[model samples]
Target: MAATETVAERPDYDPVALAESLASAADKSAKVLGDFIARQAAAGKSMVTDEFGLTQAFLELAAKMLSNPYRLAETQMNLWWEYSALWQSSMLKLMGQSTTPVVEPAKSDKRFRHEDWEEHFLFDYVKQSYLIAARWLHNTVANVEGLDEHTRRKVDFFTRQYIDALAPSNFALTNPEVFRETIASGGQNLVKGLNNLLDDIERGNGQLKISMTDSKAFELGVNIATTPGHVVFQNDLMQLIQYEPATAKVAKRPLLIMPPWINKYYILDLREKNSLIKWCVAQGLTVFVISWVNPDERHAAKDFVDYMLEGPLAALDAIEKVTGEKDANVLGYCLGGTLLAAALGHLAAKKDKRIVSASFMTSLIDFTGAGELEVFIDEEQVSSLERKMSERGYLEGSHMANTFNMLRSNDLIWSFVINNYLMGRDPFPFDLLHWNQDSTRMPAKMHS
Candidate 1:
């Protein structure tokens, strides 16, 4: 009867209400877009009027580029003629003829390494042509005028993304290694690759198959995260895991690791040898880690503020209770680090500084130079994302993983496509790759 009453007391979610709310938000987003564009137009007028910021910006760009314009052009021209010879020779090979050899670039650029790539008449031509085009595009962008520093940085970042996407290695036909593999495998590889492709398509539900990690080969807290730990505390957001002390004498300052909620906490305790948690235990420090909950619709309404309160703050409270230590050192990784920073700020504001020291690993405090990600971050794009999230209630881990894979399409996306789809090869079991594949969902409100 108690259980039944508890179940009945639970909040009743209304899909219709959610849809109406989303429609209203969409309407609001359109207004925001209009206001944003108007504000930009108004501020842009000041660039021409009050400060001449645009003129100054261009003048600075001009000074940076035109300092050695003549020498730059001459060097470019010479480089072009040199590559032209390679192209001419390659064209001869294509037409069933032969031509004399010419000097090639030393290629301190390590990415061009393919055994006898220069000797292969077809690949050599394709490779050198790509290099020349890439260099020209990069240099042209480097010298472009009329962009302010921030705008110029975004342009440069996106330009690099485009150039990387254009790399010959990304394509099955252009890549020399893939071509060799195709021959060596005698087309059986294509069959295997097709099978892999079909399997992913059949299972993936419209998501790209990135990692080929065999999930059955690994189990949590047994083979992978084998370090000894028990859940001492848990809240709506996460579980506070306190690892057993390895040394007889441990440090008074307990270490608490806060990994990004986007991934599992066991990344720190991946393997016994490579596990940072195990290493810290050996170093005679009491270690604690936060294993964030894989939230569903029940947590959809939770926001960043909720994460700050229930995540690190709750963990800190639990750590103090478990260890009887008022002060402890903290390590925050990536997105977790960002959350830690916000949480620390809030705690400090409230005069409750329990964390003695803090460490941030590869975290962002500012997005002044945020790379190609800027391309999809305009008002319209965000609104579209929110609408999608509103329908789902939360961002699926697969969806999040897809967006990240788009950031490095060549390595994370196409490499697998070539290996599993074109060459029909199986991927080896890599622990890191497995962790990467194991993504965690985020609440829509928090993610936004």
Candidate 2:
């Protein structure tokens, strides 16, 4: 009888409190629904269908698996054998015997960090069961015989997303910490969690934008981007910021930095102690950084060639005018580096030699080994994006941020979901995250 008793049967459990919390949660849930309905009615936006072409990719994967029955059978048999081992191990653990977990999470996986995940028998079983299934799914999909490279990559990427979403840690009932919190708080946490979800969806204009950190925690040119600088010149496209000289003797060649327009330039000058801009000033070099315009429809016609002619090329002419320096050392980061490389080729063609030295940071000159980002770079997807951009005049900043976030969904996306929506907690203030969420728009012509 004692063995059969559950946690709810214990003296500490209060049914009355649980009932009250549930009632409150139901009221809040109605408010959530009503707000959602009103927002939809106001916007009257239509649903976008399969913008990523995931359906076609999955169908192809299914066809390949169906044609290779033997391979599928072998993979299924392997999974069954693993499940059997896990059952035996779990049985031993339930009998108060020491047994090894059939599978362990990777060292970097933080979902299973709570002590209850290991200390409690039921949760330990759930964790191992989920891990085993996740491994089997990944291996099976990865080994599918005859899919093209692009289709295979898309399948694998989405497969990881599917598994990550279904992880036991994500759901409250299966997550020991959340379960304990629910019981202790009599489900008030859940009511709060629902409120947080509604607030976030409303903030995103009917889309869910999970808050990674407190949005009000930082400001431009204050706590961040605090390096002393003067806007020495401005073109229609960018502002040339010249930092105040830190030393009496300045270097003969000024240092000009061209940052990627995909993000704001303040990323390089985030804070004083670690700011590259500040360090350059202290190095006795007159530094000039290009702050790209946060473009809108008016600037939609600006293309890559326009960016080159008006961006670094224009900055070069401005730098020469400001500091009496005819030649300057140029550095570009990421997309900025790509643009600089193109400008070099253009200048070479015209026999111009205003740049003395050039440096690139995480810049790509070749596309053959573009890594995981290649999954979204095919002609079909590019054309689809072009059509979308034509409607908006530019790629939305949030869309670009969402794409980058998908690359590390577990870290950037799901973790916050559990913390902010499942646990009913406010995100901690983080400067780096603040910077990341402060995304900038990309002009349609330049982006295309």
Candidate 3:
């Protein structure tokens, strides 16, 4: 059993007023949604209708499909030639004559081409065909005329996702290794995989579970988060955990870690070998970490400002009290790093320097060339999301997780669908995958 630590309530938080405050915020969010949707509806005509350039792009692509079979025809003939040569080599090897394949996967495409795939000629063909199809489709879309840059990129991103999801490697019949395993085991793996699928469906309440965490394999602060620590302070937003000193005499300066509230803090202290907290302790550094609260009805009112003031800001004060040091080295990860930046600015503005040095991991500082999320940022989408957030008072964790998963849906989603359902295989147990699955809700105000 995991040890239970004592918790102390935060001095600044008011539990009684939380309900009233959240209701007011939710009402405001709803009003914003109404105004936003009205404005969007009032806008003259959509770009898709008004823009002739987009219409021309589609027409050109369709015209090429009919008139210019030469490029596609040449490509098809080359693939058939490669397949014929490979088939001949496979037959010779099977009949006791040794021969190497005529075609090999390219250097850049090595990740998709596994050694096991090359061992079997049929698997090799499937792998090569999949890669070839992807490349052809990508080039075809890239060369299409008149489409604007943004639309082209979005189309390309989703097309890759679709192609990848349809990869032969994901299915047992198309994958020689999985087929062989099914035959050797007399379909026992499939039976076990089916059971795994059923369990996941039941666990997720009928949704095909995409996460790769084997939830039964580990427990927080038991097998993981096992670094000796005491929960020294708690608030509506976070818990300040003070890890025990690993050395007889610790560093005069302490370390304060702030992980993103979107994820649980145990990611840094996953297991003994991988735990950053344990590694720091071994180096004779006293470390204190902030474990964020998963928002529900009670925490729906807390905004980013609330988090900065009561979260890391309060943790710094508590760390100072415990270690008798006014300043501590601070480190933050992702959104946590963003929050830390806000806290630092606040402290600097107030002329209080409690943070000595800072380290950040995967923090978003620049938005230029802002990446794939731009497609979902239009006024209509924001209004839709805001309306939902207004009703719930917090944006569902699944919403954020699904959005992130779309960036690589084939691997993050469909691959698992094939494995867990079609192949009947359970999710592979991995720490990083586990952390990703353990998502937390964001307050509506903070989400804004």
lDDT of model number 3 = 0.73
Q: What is residue 19's positional error in candidate 1, in angstroms? A: 50
Residue-level lDDT tens digits of model 1 in 245-343: 999999998998999999888888889889999999999999999999999889999998999889888888888888788888999999889998998
What TM-score do all the candidates reach, one by one?
A: 0.73, 0.92, 0.74
Q: Tens digit of lDDT per residue, candidate 2, span 1-448? A: 6666775564464668767756876776677667777866675644555667898999999999999899999999999999999999989989999998899999899999999889899999999999999999999999998999999999999899899999999999999988988777766677678777877876776677888999887888878899999899998899999999999998989999999998889888989887999999999999999999999988989999999999999999999998888899999999899999999999999999998899999999897988888878777788888988887799889888988999999899988888887788889988788888888998899888
**Separate clash counts for every candidate:** 1, 0, 1
Candidate 3: which pairs clash? 193-424
Please give the lDDT score at residue 17 for candidate 3.
57
Give lDDT tens digits, candidate 3, residues 288-382.
89999889866778888999999988888888787789988999988889889988899999998778898998887566656887755655567
Worst 10 residues of 1 by lDDT: 45-54
User: Order of candidates by lDDT, top first?
Assistant: 2, 1, 3
Clashing pairs in 2: none
Better-scoring candidate (lDDT), 1 or 3: 1
CA lDDT for candidate 2: 0.88
How do all the candidates rank in terms of TM-score, highest first? 2, 3, 1
Q: Model 2 — which ten-residue stretch has the worst lDDT?
A: 6-15
